[model samples]
Target: MIKNSDITVVVQGPVVASPDRAMDEGITEKCLTSVRHHLPGAHVILSTWQGQPVEGLDYDELLLNEDPGSNITEYTADGKPDASNNNRQIVSSREGLKRVKTPYAMKLRSDNYLVGDQFKFLQASFPERCEEDRFLSERVVVNNTFTRAYARSRRVALHMCDFFYFGRTEDVRALWGMSNLPDLAYDQTRNGQKQYWGAPHYKIDCTQKLLLVALQQYDASLNVEHLHDAPDDLIARSERIYANNFVIGEPELIGLGLCSKFGPQERANRLSGRLTYVNFDDWQVLYKTYCDAEFPLGMAPLRIRKRNFLRAFLLAAKLLEEALKRLKKKA
Candidate 1:
């Protein structure tokens, strides 16, 4: 049983992307309403750029930051920040943490809508033992898909999903506190390290990887876990499907329409009902359906002419060999 007193929900980011003020306010209002309804008496905090006005949202506290400098490290050659807007998250989250007084905190993006009884799942998954301090996230990114095949080949550990996170307030503070977007961007670019599969790994991906590393450095002893689990075979197949879609430049097929199926307006309505009605086991069934529908064919042509098919072929072989080794050990 998670109490509203135990948690404070932090919503942070830019307010409007376009000139349509009504559209921006509408989206923000829906997000706030969902948080208020689901969390009930939990305190809410909105953190954003200093002058960005957020009206009609019922929040307990509001924190603001001055306009961020244009010196973002994740800028492209043209000097524009990458689409991920990771620097914004770092700035807002840092500001929001200062006002967090609860024992637990849930960090959410202003644009992300919480669909289901995520809080219930959080309460059920909370680590009971003192030694097992851990954080909970909606999803986990492992190195299994084509986009992440290189890392998978190297067997890098799992990373937390950046959109939403739940943990002890102290732990949440530590995770977000370690985020130095500009420095991280400079370090990755300078070192020529590839932290993600596609595109130059952006700041969000880099920050997530660094957050996990920070846990080790600080001796936090906290493990990161996802809300749900699937069978190993299904997980592997889903990765292949996602990878196939990426290679073909079919963004529509990615995540099997789980996100696209529910647009922003529909999300508020669907999420609450789905969360209230469905159990984790049922959610897994729905996820598996999405994965199964996107099954990839073998030996597809590469979308980027410079990317070699032989390399991908060899990676498949390596993956198969590794799987065999694991199976033999089990046998």
Candidate 2:
């Protein structure tokens, strides 16, 4: 069993954005409550932008300040304010790491919720480790995981999911020391900077990727391990299907309401459990059912306005093509 005294939980980043302030408070409160419940007695800290109000949530400590060298007007590659938001995460998380007095620490984004018994999963997956053996993450976002195929075809380094991370406080602090990582990565990969190469060459939002590179510069053997215990073969198969269905396939699954329930986030939540087992065949059946459903015409307007329609259309076409190819191979 993982004791609260064994670790510190840092809830850092921007407040949950909601048109309703009450809704924001409710979401923040729920996240804090969940953290406290799972890791009872763990030191909990809330770090946010300077002047941001955090009155309702209960925490052991609260730290707020503008990001070092921040310029509110600068925009990230993803279009979020650079200094105030993206850069702030690096700054706030670093500060949070410094305050951790325990051997282990977890850095969770404000909006990222831990469902069910995820704390146990963390305990079993990571456990107590020497400083050298303490690198682990919920998800490692590789170039091929979510980016466009062309972008992934290049030699861009793998990325860590910025949502949640658990490891030794020292390792976690090293990972968070990435204030100018995006620019640094861009400069190193300048040869790949072209419109055809895709967004990653220019934008450096994947701090986890940059962290790995930084760690490797000192210790070549350091690698971030996934927090789940699925067999390697199973994980590889699941990745292929997921890449096909989501990244390389189509967006019609969303219209079918299947994706909202069984999407990547849901899959992560399920797999993080101690007993949850994933069956690829079952997922295949779900995918077929989703494809058979009528394309949600009504949703197209909203999705297009949100700039996701083209990506969905392309994904759907790719999925259909892959399916047909598979049928041909079976014949």
TM per model?
A: 0.52, 0.51
lDDT string, candidate 2, 1-331, tens digits: 5556888888887665533222234556677787777677789988877766687778999988674543342334443443323466677788888898987777776765445434333234311222222233321111121322112112122332355556566666666765543432223333433211124324433443445455565557544332222345534433332222221112121111111233456643232220122122222332333332332234444533433444345456656877888799999
lDDT of 1 at 233: 55
lDDT (0 to 1) per candidate: 0.47, 0.47
Number of residue pairs clashing in candidate 2, backbone atoms closer than 3 angstroms, sequence gap of 3 or more or interchain: 3
Instruction: Itemize residue pairs with steric clashes in candidate 2.
Output: 249-315, 250-315, 250-316
TM-score of 1: 0.52
Which has the greatest TM-score? 1
| Global CA lDDT computed for model 2 | 0.47
Q: Candidate 1: where is the Cα deviation over 4 Å? A: 18-25, 74-84, 126-158, 183-204, 216-331
Q: Candidate 1 on 1-331: residue-level lDDT in tens?
A: 6587788888877666543212344555666777877678888998878677676667888887875643343444443443345556677887797689998787776765455434444334312221122232222211111222233333222222355556567766666775444432433343444332123422223433444444554444433222122235534543332222111111121111112223435642242222222122322232334434443333332322223344456557767998999899999
- Looking at candidate 1, the ten consecutive residues that score lowest on lDDT are 246-255
Candidate 1 achieves a global lDDT of 0.47
